[model samples]
Target: MKKILLSFFLLTFFQNVVAQTNLYENPNFDELAKTHKIIAIVPFKTQVQLRPKQMKDMSAEQLNRVEKSEGESIQTAMYSWFLKRKKRGDLQNLEIQDPRTTTAMLKKQTIDYNNIMDFTPQELAKILEVDAVISGEFETNKPMSEGASVALGVLFGFFGSTNSATINMSVHNATDGILLWNYNKKVSGSIGSNTEDLINVLMRKSSRRLAYTKNSKDKD
Candidate 1:
């Protein structure tokens, strides 16, 4: 019985690892990156697939609130990750706008985060006064406790429980509002997985291809 259970667990784990998907990455990203002096990481559109128990317990309003919060959390995480990387010299002359500033500006404009998707990318960039924008959608198959995830990551680097999430990140030119680069990936979480870990994992895989970091490899 023990052997059977172990085998099954291993199979499930491996499946999770192998099941991660990369949907697309724009090829002309480098050209776009070079022109960017500042970029905004906007709140993502979040779709949480709640468990049956959660559906029964949570009201629609509660769910909507949580979803909105998750979008901001993800936006902040992505910004911090890029800031750290840029500070570490991985990204040269790249600036990620402060989330607070973005929020304030948007609020003054009467733009609600929930209605962000309705705006054109060009319009958003102009409002934010950025060279480009990084925006995307986040989808998750499980309920995640954001605080618990961060605590676990800080205490134990890798031994944490995980859920599955997918992200579609795109960069748009502030001038033309055209998508300059895009990347999509499906990732799994572990006990130690936090927002930072997730963003780091995704960025490491995609950043080399990102125009802003094209010279990162040659820097050392």
Candidate 2:
């Protein structure tokens, strides 16, 4: 019984791991990243699909609110993950703009989150005064809350949870409005998971392939 249960657990974990796929990557990612000094992480676009029963019970307005809030949470998570990695010297020459500052500047410019995708990457990069911009979109099967996310790995022993997400991340050059790189992946998260945990896992895999990181040259 013990062996059977352990095998099931390992299978689930590995299944999730294998689901992450790279959809796109730029040929000149390294050169482009080196040329751009600072990068700003924009708020992610989040979409949640509630279960049939939950959808029947929850109002659309409530779902919209959760979606909008989760966007900001994910943006902060991305920045924080990169910042911490940089601080620990795990990332070299990769400077991430503070998410607080990025949001504040966007607010001051009267840019609404819902309408953010309408804006060109060049315009956003110029407004943020960053040499490069990082943007992403996330789709999840449930309304993800920071607390619930953190609780998964923390309380549930790093196994068995209900969250599944697909994330698409991109980088654009400020000066020329060219997309330098992009990465997309599908992930299944655990019960005690949060935005930080999600982004941390994604970034750990994706960043290794990104340009400007210490190990970029060594990867090829």
- Per-model TM against the reference: 0.80, 0.80
* Candidate 1 lDDT, 1-220, residue by residue in tens: 9999989975765555533556454566677677778999889888877667655776777677767777888898888877777888877887889999999988888887779998988999999999998899988754344753343334334433667788888888899888887778887745124566566656765777777775565321
Candidate 1 regions exceeding 4 Å error are: 1-16, 23-27, 143-160, 189-191, 217-220
lDDT of 2 by residue, 85-157 (tens): 6766756666788988898888888886788998988999999999989898988875456643443224333
Q: Which ten residues in a row have the lowest lDDT in candidate 1?
A: 148-157
User: Each model's number of backbone clashes?
Assistant: 6, 10
